[model samples]
Target: MIGRYIWEISELRRSHHGLTLNELNERWERSSLYDGREIIRKTWYSHREQIASQLGIIIECDKRTNRYYIAYEDTIGRPDIQNWLLNSFAVGNMLMQGKDLKGRISYERIPSGYDYLTDIIEAMRENRIISISYQSYWKDEPSEFELMPYALKVFKQRWYLVGANVAFEGIRIYGLDRIKNIEITQQKFKMPKSFDVEELFEPYYGVSLVDGEVEKVRIKVYDNQAKYFRSLKLHESQEEIKTTPEYSIFEYHIKPTFEFEQELLSHGESVEVLEPAYLRERIKKRLEWSLEHYK
Candidate 1:
């Protein structure tokens, strides 16, 4: 509760408020941080440090004035960490308020029926190749493939493994749920010295097919959704070049992929493909074809 309360105060207004043991008691109201009337100094800071370390974030306090603030920047884009912290805070809040969210709270839904997460992680850690029995939805039967597991990512609530397929030249992404069996090989492989996870996935959205030249893709987000784009960017390359009360124009430098196109389509009528005329035409044709199905 001390950590959660302190984080909230620091986040809303940093220097304007200096939080001390008394202020924490006033906020949390008769928590474990105090012994009835006195603030327990050692235990309070110990809990704060524990929460900060777990979240991989820093919360700074000035001893001279006892004011607290978050010293870290660049927190907006990381949905995973943000979701975790928000859930943690919610649970703490409910407990302190003498209420249980229980049925009122629905957890983030992760697609089930995948079991190869640990095996792939260990293979990546050991720099070893793994043989997997994978059955893609498009195929009739399961196929065996050996892959040098590089990185694992969670997208749309499903886990995916990205690495070099032995039969394929470049890295390929395989869905973990589609993988039936995992056999870690004794064979060791060297990860390329220049293979950076971020750089590899930077030009694409979600798990990509890894085709085509990278383009400075641009799009126009109309109506209320523009505010959401400003807060949670579509990609690291996303830039908001124009804005008005009616609409906002966003530019992105991304390799056009099925995943990226589908993402844009999800926003529906609120979004339009603005630049890269070819991409705009592609979306227009797709929408026309979609309308045909209803007819």
Candidate 2:
């Protein structure tokens, strides 16, 4: 019931711009989840506190307009994990209310590794180590190891754990789907003060880190394909260096890793690597290899 109210209050504030206590209550009274009793100011304040603490959403008042609104609206959208959490709850709440329309709604099924998320998150929070039996795609058998959990990332509807292997000296990314079994340990490890997950990943395109120098890379995206790159950037360093009626040239300071090359290849003929002659040659070779298969 409280979960439903949280979603309602959040949705109301997000869509309406802002609302006063009375304005909020008026809408709540008419809401589908509303009970016979009216929500007093005390209860409303309690709900506000719960929303902030549980969802990391802040409801602050605009003193000039005397209306309540969601704070850090721009910042909230920046973190993908936080956004996913809020969206999950909001969707669950909506699904509960619309039980009759069960078959009407469709969702993408994310593959395995969900079972390990809670344990991994707890381990990360407590700064403890985790034991995992992982099955790598290239390997024939599962291997057990202990990891100092650092951070979690979701990309392309898949979850990945970025952590340090206790027996090894460097950080590595593990796909959750590949984890056969996992257990959290009571033993704690201090996360490195110098380690910044964002900084670590800033130079790459995907979760897989490749060993290479970051180069000044440019790609020419043609026709309608330019709109997709414009709306959804290929990389954070992406900048429109040149524009024409037929195409647009986007530049980036990135490592042309295997994942990055695959991404560029996904665009096929629509994208052409302009600079970094080696990367261009690499892409050309891959395309030629692909062409041979078709022929």
By TM-score, the best candidate is 2
Displacement of the residue 287 alpha carbon in candidate 1, Å? 0.6
- For each candidate in the order shown, give its overall lDDT on alpha carbons: 0.74, 0.84
289: Cα error in model 2, Å: 1.9
> How close is each model in CA RMSD to the real structure?
5.6, 3.1
The count of residue-pair clashes in candidate 1 stands at: 0
Each candidate's TM vs. the true structure?
A: 0.70, 0.86
Look at candidate 1 and tell me the lDDT of residue 271.
Answer: 97
Predicted structure 2: lDDT: 0.84
For residue 141, model 1's alpha carbon misses the true position, in angstroms, by: 1.8
- lDDT by residue for model 2 (1-295), tens: 5665565555654666688778777776866677767767797788878887666777788889888876655444356655666676677777666666778987678785899988998898799999999999999999999999998887777889999999999889999999999999988999998887778889998898888788999999999999999999988999998999999999999877788999999999999999899899999999999999998
Specify the highest-lDDT model's number: 2
Which pairs of residues collide in model 2?
none
